[model samples]
Target: MDKSGNMIDKMLTQNGLVYKIPNKVAAKQGPAFLQKQRSGSVAYTQGVAAEQQACHWLEQDGWTVLLRRARTHRGEIDIVASKAAVLCFVEVKKRRSIEEALVSLQPAQQRRLFRAAECLLQKHPYWQYEEMRFDLFVFDNAGKMERLEDILRQM
Candidate 1:
């Protein structure tokens, strides 16, 4: 059981699924579904990798990570972190530039973030904190984190 878990863990760690290529020859024949399928697969893999990195970064900074890739009816919160007395809900954007990163967040995305946070609060009322806020994490194409901004404080 431990060995199976370890194998799954290794397969899950990093964006290992991104390397999986679809049958391009099959795609060319008719529907071209393989291309879209591969793209979606890669996206899911990248999202997992980004979530893992965000959790690791928060933990390194001394915050206890509560969750990663937390989902609600509205949308997903990439990371949930707590320390001292604050609960931070995070959205991670991975891009090639700062502009691209910021552009990734739209008004609809903000609404989803708020709804997800509210859902979390409802579920975990015992998790007391002096404050709660939504945060944005920007990661460059090289997998380096460039910025972390608290969007809640601004609003």
Candidate 2:
């Protein structure tokens, strides 16, 4: 038994029933682990909300959203949208300031996004387009939004 009065190991009963035990390490971590999990959940929810807003903005601009939160072996693509013959892989970032959000997407992450886009194209051959580009959509906590088109072209 640990300090919390919980059994740290499995207990066997005379009636041939075995009681499952909690992990001692996890039990010991307790509140700290739970706090981390809660923060992670909050971040995930915020990310989803940002992606939804990005999709809405795209639709307003005559773009059709093909996929939201598209997952590949490389990484996740926030939004895949098409307008006419152009296809865009958009990366959404939300931060306290536009500069902060823009800087959050580093070069390594850009490489991952490129690889993820390739993986997605391979998986969905029907997403063909005459032109494809990478874009960055940033939102600051002040409700300001900005779109940087052909983000990789400048790289």
Candidate 3:
């Protein structure tokens, strides 16, 4: 590999293009899908961008964000934020319209978020003092934001 990396050898004989790619793990990422970094998918990129937009929207509304993409073995929290001593475990949904986004947080995902939040609080005791609630930050395709505050668990 070192001999191949030597520019002198490449300059002497060029049957193919010279490209040396680095082998490094992805930084600041959730676990790789199927153990591979499938980074170019449009849906994944849009979802990430939606989460970032949700963060900005929360900040503008006087919410103090504590964490972005907090993960547990079971699931991930999109944003952990607080305002007026009330901590919110936020789940963000992005869709073609605000109404569509509102309906996107399915019951199964809600359960996962709640379970993840419980696990996270157990590990980090300091947040336990604050009153915790579930919220949904819904965004449309055009980047408009809406809030569904204190989502109730479906019975």
Best by TM-score: 2
Model 1 Cα lDDT, one tens digit per residue, 1-155 = 13343211222335555344444444344435656788789877876787788888888989899988888887888889998998999888877776788789998888888888889889888898998877788777777776555785435
Error of 1 at 149 (Å): 2.5
- Arrange candidates by lDDT, descending: 2, 3, 1
What is the Cα-based lDDT of residue 9 in candidate 2? 75
Which model, 2 or 3, shows the larger TM-score? 2
lDDT, residue 9, candidate 3: 22
Candidate no. 1 TM-score = 0.74
TM-score of each model, paired residue for residue: 0.74, 0.82, 0.69
> What is candidate 3's lDDT per residue for 43-98, written digit by digit as tens?
67888998898888889989888999999998999999988879898888877899
TM-score for candidate 2, residues paired by index: 0.82
What are the Cα lDDT values of the candidates? Answer: 0.76, 0.88, 0.78
Cα deviation in Å at residue 11, candidate 3?
A: 24
